[model samples]
Target: MTVYLEDEQQFFEKHLGLLEKVEAVINQCLDQEEVPYEVEVSLTIVDKAEIQEINLEHRQIDRPTDVLSFPQIDPECIGKINWDNLDTSSCVNYDTEEIILGDIILCDEIAALQAEEYGHSLEREVCFLVAHSMLHLLGYDHMTEDDEKNMRQKQENVLQCLAILR
Candidate 1:
């Protein structure tokens, strides 16, 4: 997995070792999901205002959230599509010879507050968010109670697997 990470406010510099943590989360999630193709994920860390605007624009929600994932792969196409036989690859990034997994937008300000609220380091909070978003990009969601529980367990497992604990 290749992550194109952009820190809008240089928060990674403040948090220390944040980039490595995020990269770990992304890699671990992709591995856990067993994604068939070489993949690229775009991650951007933004502030509260930026996230709020994005939330409104994309989700029609006016409030800021911790993270948002825009997955390029359709869940419907997962099992049905033949990886080797697909002639026209809409999701393929030809130059990189990787699938475009899509984007994850994180709220730097929200992560800091959540870290403080949850009594964990900012790195831990951000890493958790990265794991959650990575799961989303891999076609996981929490739309139902069972689904939420499953996602929670998956996120916790990823965090624990990485030894990124509270």
Candidate 2:
């Protein structure tokens, strides 16, 4: 997994360790799932105003969201894909570079608010959001009860692997 971070807001302090941990979580999830394809993900950090604009444009909500994922996977990637089993190491050929994923947008302001509301550290909230977004990029959704349960379980598993579970 390759994460390109664009910090458009100075709201939260730039912590490399935290960013690294989030990337590790993404990578761990990918490896654990045994995806036999390389992926490149972008993380754009924005303030309330920027995220609100994005939310309005993309979702027409006119409000800030915790995170948003723009997936690049296709119908074949989902329908004919055997997600149950894969070989992680065989996914990527380091000699010839290839990109497999897309971008993710995160709202720093909303994340801060959620952390305060959930009574947890900012790091935990951000990590959780990252994990959630990663799942979205991996063809996971929470639009229904069963989907929500499965996605939540995947999130918890990734977080637990990183020892970030509550």
Best by lDDT: 1
Scanning candidate 1 in windows of ten residues, the lowest lDDT window is 77-86
Residue 8 lDDT (model 1)? 83
In candidate 2, the residue pairs with backbone N, CA or C atoms under 3 Å apart (3 or more residues apart, or in different chains) clash, namely 36-91, 37-91
Candidate 2 C-alpha lDDT tens digits along 38-155:
6778899988888889889988998888998886663244223354453334443355454456678998889889999999888889999988887777777787888799888888
lDDT of each: 0.85, 0.76
- lDDT by residue for model 1 over 1-166, one digit each (tens)? 7888788899878878779888988888877777677889999989999999999999999999999999887664322334455443778788889888899999988999999999998889989998988888777788888888988898999999999999
RMSD of each: 2.2, 4.2
Q: What clash count goes with each model?
A: 0, 2
- lDDT at 142 for candidate 1? 85
Q: What is the lDDT of residue 104 in candidate 1?
A: 93
